[model samples]
Target: MRDRGPLFGETVLFTGTPKSPEVFNLVKQYGGTPISLPLIQVAEIEEADDERKMNECSHFDWLIFTSQSAVEAFRAKMLRFGFSADLIHSKIAAVGTKTAAALEKIGFNVSFIPTVFSADTFVKQFQPETNRQLNVLFLRGNLAGSLIKEELPFHVVEWTVYKTEKQLSSIGKILNILDEATSVNILFASPSAVHIFAEAIAASRGWEGFTICAIGHVTEQALIEAGAPRVDVKPETYTLIDLVNALARRKEGL
Candidate 1:
């Protein structure tokens, strides 16, 4: 049976490589056509200096993972370095449900998760008992914010688990798709994606006709800072479903 719904006539393009099937399917379930154009390719650093960072994992009081990518990258590095899961004696905290689940899958029970998912929320929810001083090790990508360190009173150690680089070939394909698109609703998931997308567009001339939809405030600011016109901004939830649903709601209003 043919379904007629809110997104029945809408076509959407998704950027970034989807790490999960749930998110991938969510895009299709909504009546919109889905296009996957990964603008960034994540690569693990295997240098001796980078490996030394993982050796110091046992020194922290808490190991915080901000994204599933971080968790995966950290795990792979740990295995490569001959470090066992037991090396992670510090209590683990994850920034979001997906990250928490990733940690759990590898037998590390997450000790804390913020009610809201953001660097600010994560730092706010962190409480240090009077008897205990905390030294937190944050695992993230190269483009991650330093806001967590700025906001926290505890001693913080940051490790860049993975590095994201612009995939120029993918960007070229994205540009081609944008050129052929009638009305492109470009969704930005992170501030990094926003920056990378802007850089890609600028390098490819410009996305003058496409409507830009940022996933959150940070991304909105990034878009504006990059000289792109803003079309919409999603809330703090930062889920693909939320963005898709919000897009559907806007279409209904129109």
Candidate 2:
């Protein structure tokens, strides 16, 4: 595959939900083998208490959405509670373009969106002094990072809209791919993905021969903390397209 180009014959293993097809196609287009090993399974919380928590979401000052799953979960809960889209009077802040687009699709205009997508950068860019005592309501998954809540100086309400768990059954598929491929590039999108990948690798006696690539600093840190060595940490970018483009550029340079 190196005969075709830098990444012509490389196999890239993707973990997490198959949310973005664009990134997968781009890897294949560059002559790289794209493998999917979905480690985190996402499902809506259907408990009565979960329904009750979403009902009180309208009382906050701002509704912050971090992922597309959070937006979808919030929308489903709103619909179940018989609340219209306008029931949320609080302004909306989305972390990335995808989350903002999801809110817009549901008839809500995102008031604030950070140029950088990570929680740390979002907090740095947030002007809490200007909007002092802002009561921000965060809609997120069960395994979400506490960076936003810990850093914000104002009141922050965290509403758990979804949950992520590791799928051990996916270990077989990942091991099969690793056994067949000449070289593999593990692409980690989140800290949870990093943890799950590490668990899977440990179960399969490690992917020591493969190259591990993390989307951002948080994921890279997770990989290191999990005892994975030589991780390729990328610059901060919200989209997987940027990650793939950066990989292509690196391959060209090599």
Candidate 3:
């Protein structure tokens, strides 16, 4: 990395899973002190018809994945049931680069990614190549919104591959940071995490000197609703790596 990078003197408090060391490494790569305090946890949902759905994968024209967690959960389920990617004939659509990368790693090709990485933009930009009616399957978590199914112009079916749960065990440490740190950069990746943080930390600590960073418009809106006076850093691209780069740029005032 660059010596004394843009984020040289910053302390970044990550609110996502610590299982993703890449994100924490990114902060350190940019010369920032990274702190891991997961605000949410993701777990696979064991549905009764999971085997049947896996068997019928080829029936859908498109498979949509909104988060990397969904991709990982799907991959795990596929492995547990001895299913292979060869069984899938449908084109894949991912909401973000990381999700697409995860799908690619699992031997599937991503056919579409929205200009912006949010579902609202995805619905507006995604369209079928032919006039024929298309069948789509969205693999998502329990907390995923209904915007995709409600807005897509095609026949859409949803499969809950995962569930996002609040992780408030680290609230004490988060409170300690807020109380002791002179200044901190708090990064939020999802709306669910924002809500948890709002309840556990923000309700008491408030947003005083913390530099609130959001991954995308959705999370940014959540932060705004959670009483973040202003979002200090938000990348045009909505990904964790881009979020770190944006934070570095902000530190350097570029």
The C-alpha TM-scores of every prediction are: 0.87, 0.89, 0.95
Supply candidate 3's per-residue lDDT for 205. Answer: 74
Write one digit per residue (lDDT tens) for candidate 1, span 71-168: 88988887787877777688898987778989998879898988767777788887856576688898879988889878888888888878987766
Q: What's model 3's TM-score? A: 0.95
Clash number by candidate, in order: 0, 0, 0
* Candidate 3 residue-wise lDDT, 1-254, digit = tens: 34688777778998987546787898887888999888999999988888988988889999999899999899989998998788789999999888888899999999999989999999999986887999999998999999999999899999999999988787898888877886689999899989999998888778877899999999999999888898998999998888988888888775
How many clashes in candidate 3? 0
Which scores better on TM-score, 1 or 2?
2
Question: What do the candidate models score in CA lDDT, each in turn?
Answer: 0.74, 0.79, 0.89
Number of the candidate with higher lDDT, 2 or 3:
3
Better of 1 and 3 by TM-score: 3
RMSD of each: 2.7, 2.4, 1.7
Shift of residue 180 alpha carbon in model 2, Å: 1.3
Leading candidate by TM-score: 3
Query: What tens-digit string does per-residue lDDT give for candidate 2 at 202-227?
Result: 54576487777777777778888988
